[model samples]
Target: MTNDVIIRRTIEWMEGHLHEEVTAEDIAAQAGFSKFHFHRLFQSAVGMSFTEYLRLRRLTNAALALIHTDERIIDIAMHYCFDSQEVFTRAFKKVYGFPPGQYRRQMMSLMKMKEEKQMEETLKGWFLSGSHPFNYEMGADVETVHQGKQSGYLKSKTVTPAEGEFATMMQQFKADRYRGKRMKLSAFLKTEDVQHMASLWMRVDSASEEVLQFDNMSDRPIQSTSNWNHYTIVLDIPENSAVISFGMILSGSGCIWADSVTFEEVDEKTPTTNLQTEIVMLDEPVNLAFEES
Candidate 1:
């Protein structure tokens, strides 16, 4: 199997066993790799070590429990396999910058305020636009998230959207820092009842508004319902590129949640998903003669 597939399967396994005791040695054995080798591979594929990923995921879930449930903090911590309340508290405070009690109180207040405002609010650094943007509601979803306290979401407001109608939640910024580099955009996405399609998209545009590179995952669109899954788009930013724009687009009816979005520069050895690079052109006209066939 390809390394990507192996890593993905390993992550799925890890997610399923998050509540149980797991070790790198055990996971490596299951994957048919030495512990050391698997550690390196997992880090390269996931952008973090296995132990760190596990800790963060556990802490994220614990945070959710703190927000959504009235369970004792110690119980929530123990349920996630942390050794003790003290250990969990220290780790949680280190990441969240607040103790469990304070974090829960603050998050609960924020969530209550968010629900009161709901669709009337706009996500900072993002805007809604598409063929029929009014037919959709885009905002932060605190209840359904893949990681962290909340995720950004877009959902259809009407059951009978006009044919060919669509909407996108997008952001654009100066591409000066990424120019002349291969940049990767990664995000976890979940979908429900996506009738047409949904995709994570990115584009690099030149100063004249010409497309420099772009990919919308058209060849592998997300349709129907799906659990959270990691997706990425890689593209080379031309030196003349002036803006980088990206977001999730939902076509037709459905809802999609996006979380943990990130961008990082990658080595040239990493293949780009830029759709513009997929087209083939000849340096000069060839095979003009019928005999060439």
Candidate 2:
């Protein structure tokens, strides 16, 4: 199997066994890799060591419990495998910048105010559009995020969506600054129950809306489910390009969270992920007659 598949499966296993005590050595054994090799591979694939990822994920879940449940802080800490309440408090405070009690109170107040507003607020600087946008809900999920305070999400509202139905949370802007440059778009994404597919897409268009370059990661779609992983697409912005558009797309039923989106210029050594291929036109229609075959 590919390294990515192995890491994803290891993350799934780690999540399932969070309530129990498991060390890097045990996990490495489970994955059939040596301790030192697994440590390096995990760090490279995830951008963090296995222990750190586990701690942060556990803290994230604990924070959620603090917000959504009345569970005692100590119990929540213990449930997530923290040794004691003191240790949990220190770790939680280090990441969240507040003790559990204060964090819970502040988040609860903010959540209550949000609920009172009773309206679906569109994510700023982004819009939703697709084949069946009404079948999906798009929003900023502050509670469940890959990093920082929030992450943008697109989730299927209807389980029985029609075939080929999809939705996208996208944005477009003038491409004047990026013209004639190789640009790379990267984001951290997590998926759940993605029945069909999810992808990060980008397109460079001309003044009249002709696609000059495009890639939707169709060759490498995220399906079923996956833990937070970084994905990237690179394309050259042609001189005639007028607009640059990009977003995350979800087809069929599923949920996807996107965070830490970034765009930067890359050197010529970096290959473009553009899926558009050159088209050759024939001089004339050669198969007009049925007997030609």
- Per-residue lDDT for 17-128 in model 1, tens only? 7799998788887667998998998887667887787788889889988999999999999999999999999999999999999999999897777544544465788888
Q: Pairs clashing in candidate 1?
A: none
Q: Write the per-residue lDDT of candidate 2 for residues 1-293, one digit (tens) a residue.
A: 86666876777788787788999888988777998898898875556788888888788889888988999999999999999999999999999999999999999998888752211464777888899988898888876776657789999999878999999999999999999999988887899999999999999999999999999999999998887766878899999999999999999999999987988888997678899999999998887777875
TM-scores for candidates 1 onward, in order? 0.85, 0.77
Clashing pairs in 2: none
Q: Which stretches of candidate 2 lie over 4 Å from their true place?
A: 1-10, 24-50, 116-122, 192-195, 224-230, 264-271, 280-293
Q: Count the backbone clashes (under 3 Å) in each candidate.
A: 0, 0
